[model samples]
Target chain A: EAGVAQSPRYKIIEKRQSVAFWCNPISGHATLYWYQQILGQGPKLLIQFQNNGVVDDSQLPKDRFSAERLKGVDSTLKIQPAKLEDSAVYLCASSSIKDSYGYTFGSGTRLTVV
Target chain B: SQQGEEDPQALSIQEGENATMNCSYKTSINNLQWYRQNSGRGLVHLILIRSNEREKHSGRLRVTLDTSKKSSSLLITASRAADTASYFCATAALSEKLVFGKGTKLTVNP
Candidate 1:
């Protein structure tokens, strides 16, 4: 089976600009998650989706960050008016209760704010 | 705040030696998972131990969870150069989110 897939392996944008990342989880997986990982830090959950419905978003910087998992198989995370602090690796992961032992993560999108 | 914190922020050891990393959490958890990240890439799932499990093993990896102590330890037996990577432990609380620790950087020299 294929692992989670993410697009735009790398991106460079200016402050106050906007960028969007796309993710496709492994087949038949119903739970999706978005995480932000700064250098030298563990990945932090930005949002989580269970079959297209949100399970958590409390950590998301709602004012600038938005995400959606439409149709329950794919997801997209957007950052508007990107800030220098928003520059980090965006990772997407998926899991299921029946297979909750672990999660499958994407290679991630490395965003550079200039 | 419920994230796990790994001890010995970094570790350096030689191949054929045993490597151990410890993690502590502050809240109750259903399970704890360990992951490995090479360089700045995505993480790879390693081992998962439930709160009820005291010890588990997979190949060269051994994980021990102590709910009473709210801590866990991962031991890689006879580690190899390929085992060099950043290791992280994540705790899954009631919120269903996997809170992760800062991670431990391990360097296995051959």
Candidate 2:
């Protein structure tokens, strides 16, 4: 089986500019998630989706960040007016369910906002 | 508010030695998971230990969870050079969100 796939392994943008990241999860997985990892820090959950519906996004910055899982297979995360603090590795992961199972992560998009 | 915090931000050891990393969390959790990430790649699931379970073993990796202490530890026995990477411990709360710790960077010298 193929693993989770993400686009644009690296991205460089200017402050106040807009950037978008894409993720294609593993086949048959029912849950998808987006996380941000700053340098020397662990990943912080930005949003989560289960079958095209959002399961949780309480930690996401509603004023600047948004994400959607169109067909429940592929998802996209966007950040508008990016700030220097937004520069981090955006990781995408997928899992079969909400149980104790672990997640499969994608290569992640490293965004550098100058 | 980070839910998990790992101790000894970095670790260096020689091949054939054992490497141990510890993680502590603030709240109750359903399960705790360990993951490894190479330089710039994504994280790979190493193991998962449920709250009701005390210990789990996978190959050279052993994970022990102590719910009473709200902490977990990952032990890599006879570590190899290829084991050099960042290891993270994530806690899955009842709310279904997995909160991660800052991770420990391990460098295994050959």
lDDT of 1 by residue, B1-110 (tens): 43799998999999999999999999899899999999979999998898889999999999999999999999999999999999999999755679999999999999
Q: Per-residue alpha-carbon lDDT of model 1 for A31-80, expressed as tens digits?
A: 89999999999999999998999999999999999999889988999999
Computed on C-alphas against the true complex, the DockQ of each candidate is 0.75, 0.86
Q: What is the C-alpha lDDT profile of model 2 across B1-110, one tens digit per residue?
A: 68889887999999999999999999989999999999888999999999999999999999999999999999999999999999999999776678999999999999
Off by over 4 Å in 1: none
TM-score of chain A of each: 0.97, 0.96
- CAPRI grade of model 1: medium
Q: State each candidate's clash count.
A: 0, 0
Candidate closest to the true structure, highest TM-score: 1
Which stretch of 10 consecutive residues in model 1 chain B shows the poorest summed lDDT? B91-100
lDDT of 2 by residue, A29-71 (tens): 8889999999888999999998899999999999999999998
